[model samples]
Target: MKKGENTRKHIISKAAELFNQKGYAGSSMSDITELTGIKKGGIYRHFASKDEIALEAYNYAGSIVGGHIQEAIRQQETAFGKLLSYLRVYVNVVEEPPFIGGCPLLNAAVECDDGHPILRQRAQQGLEGTLGNIKAIIMQGIESGEFKADIDVDALATFTLSIMEGSVMMSKLEGDNRHVRMNIENFSAYLRAVCVQN
Candidate 1:
């Protein structure tokens, strides 16, 4: 890659780690400079401000989690397996640190709040996109007669996401992964229960 492109990518990558660990408000320009071993003015050449870096970091972290789910779904043969796979993916993700802190999107939601509108919107969009993917898979199951026709795909999708997010928050705050595991299991059980055929 070109020198400038490499520098920009490096800044975004290092900034993502700091933002994920310290959050937007907690991460300062000097912190990023120290971590990256780059001067503050050097960072400015790549990013206008901390907010710009935060937005990019949020997007960068979000892409990692989103890509995992999408890959899991793509690998499954049926919608039944896909939904289960999605939940399983969440289970595995939470067991790992950083992710164990929960989803970047959820973290960004609470961190950004009213202070950063762009970051907040990115979080919202990330969540909405995740829900939509789940809803689509549920709809597919319904069409294939695997899931009950009466199942409200949208409602169930939202509920499933809510449980995961809530459990993640609890796990992070409590410094335990048990709640997250239990929550994912509950989601899996619910999926099996709602299916037309076992």
Candidate 2:
């Protein structure tokens, strides 16, 4: 990569960690400079404003987490396996997150709501993408005869995302992975029960 591109990525990487951990409002230009060792003028050389950095950082964080989940899903052979893999990824996130903070989508959504419209919209897009992936997996399972035909893909996808996000939040707040693990186990059981018998 070019020198300027490398600097831009460095800024985004450092800024993403700060934003994910301290949040957009909590993280300032000084914090970014301190974390990245880049001057305010240098940061501005790449990003026009803090909002621009926040948006890019949000996208960067989302990509990191999303790529991790996608890789896990790709390793599975079946839709049911992929679904379980998806749940397992979130469970793992409670212990070893892809980013410094927990789920970026949840963090950004909570922090940006009613404050930063752009960041909030980005978070929403990340969530919708996740929901779409889950729904697609369930649809695949149904078409492949692995899951019951009567199952509600949209509702289940929403439920799965909600449970995982809530569990992650609870676990992060309490500094315990039990909540996430238990919820994931329960979700896995639900999937197995719903799956068609071979």
TM-score for candidate 2, please give it. 0.95
> Of the candidates shown, which would achieve the greatest TM-score relative to the real structure?
2
- What tens digits encode model 1's per-residue C-alpha lDDT throughout 1-198? 898888888888788888877888888888898988889888889888888888887777777777777787789988867766655665544457434245787788888889889999988898888888889988888888888899878898888778877777776777777777887677667778766565
- For candidate 2, lDDT tens digit of each residue in 1-198? 899999999999899999998999998899999999989999999999999999999889889988988998899978877876655776656568767898889999999889999888888888889999999998988898888898888998898788878888988898888888898788878878766544
Of candidate 1, the 10-residue stretch with the lowest lDDT total is 92-101
TM-score of each: 0.90, 0.95
- RMSD (Cα, Å) of candidate 2? 1.4
- RMSD in angstroms, all models? 2.0, 1.4
Backbone clashes in model 1? 0
